[model samples]
Target: MHLFAMLRLILLGTTLLFSLITLGLAANLVDKLGDQWSFPGFAVAVSVLTILAVVPMIVIDLLRRGALMSWVVVELPIMGILWVLWLSSAALSTSVGLFLGDCSSFSFDSALESLCRQYSALQAFSWLNWLLVKTYVIVTLALAILALMKGHKRVWFSPVSDLSFSPTHTHSGEPKIPPPATAPGGYNPDPRMAHNHSASPSSGYPPNQPPTLYSPPSGQYPPQQQPYQSPYPNQGPAQYGSPVQTYQSPPPHAAQV
Candidate 1:
């Protein structure tokens, strides 16, 4: 556990004990006096409220302390309210002359002296509880302010017990960096340059290798293409007309021999 957390628990335990004591003394006085005074009743009320509030918080700190359970938003307000309550109770007791005179002044009557001592005790414990709460609240607020200045904005909603008042890092304790882009065969490629080997020269691809031509896959041949025929053909002579008759020459030379 953190040192702050342990200290906080110790303070809470002490405050709870003080509140219980104050409650007992106040209740006893109120029962004996029977509404003759209002401060004792107010003290009883404050003590009851303190007990009711502190018990649940102690349980939370013990069993279910977490970001949500121990959130600053939740815890600080309760502490501040209790601090005010205890302060008011203590101030009221003092202003009502509960701690005005020495207990021995009432020595003429044993009962009066005992009651005076109890009143003094009640006032003392109320002040003590107020001091405890005030100290815790001031420390917590100071740490919160430090955390904010240090850029731990999440600490406002984070568990009080887990605050470090510093910038938190990843689990590995190093700043997170993105993985480099990689190509096949474990080749790390520069992100500023394209990885396409066949990209044009203007496209910023490296000119180390000449561009290759597209070819059919290995072990596979292209399908044979049929011969092309013209859509228009020449007309045949028989389709045009019959052959023209040729002029006949008689064999006149055989008669002369």
Candidate 2:
């Protein structure tokens, strides 16, 4: 995921850089070529080029965070604008060429007169320009609304703006877990079970048996008097307080005690 995120960031930055370069080239071209319909047509082309370039970045962002609907809300109108601009530019260029052909050799005054005379031709051009500008304005405003609606204030009109609509974390505001508390040696004996090492005399095993591990001595002994020895001689002598003890008693006085 980290590598994928880094890839996304690289792609997004590259897209922004490319968009700026294209825009700079567009500005220089517009200045050099003058502000004819062709210049605006180039502007439309640059916008479309920018939009196409960033689409992959937007798709990756959407897939990473599941923001598909938000993506649509922002991108659909921009696509519509591009379509209108390209379509209108082509149609209007053809219409103008046809309209001027009839008065091709006319003077400026005569051309103006002919232009005014052909109201249908004038109206066609007007409608095409209107649609082009109208689409631009509408798409721009829709993008603005989408950005605000998704709480992305910094990326309203930018070329790579769609990458900003990240999804809210589904696990946000959940409680965190602390590490498990442990005692020395990574062992945490339960307080209730910490002091239960004493042996019960009612069981066949004598109190002298080891607390954990035990084995009989190698010496031969009667089956009824199996050998037993104190496991913790350092603690104290073992007690033989009940009848369960079957071994030969140590000393009469010691056994009585």
Model 2 TM-score on a 0 to 1 scale = 0.26
lDDT for each residue of candidate 1 in 1-257, tens digit (9 for 90 to 100): 76777877888889889989999999999987888889899999998888887777778867886735578878889899999999999998888885466889888999989899998998889999999999988988888777666556566787777654344444443433456766555655455454453364434323454556689887699778899986545444443467754446669997788
Model 2 sits at a Cα RMSD from the real structure of 17.3
**Where is model 2 more than 4 Å wrong at Cα?**
36-222, 226-257
| lDDT for 90 (candidate 1) | 93
Best by TM-score: 1
- The positional error of residue 134 in candidate 2, measured at the CA in angstroms, is 27
Which residue pairs collide, candidate 1? none
**Alpha-carbon deviation at 57 in model 1, angstroms:** 1.5
What is residue 34's positional error in candidate 2, in angstroms? 1.9
**Pairs in steric clash, model 2:** none
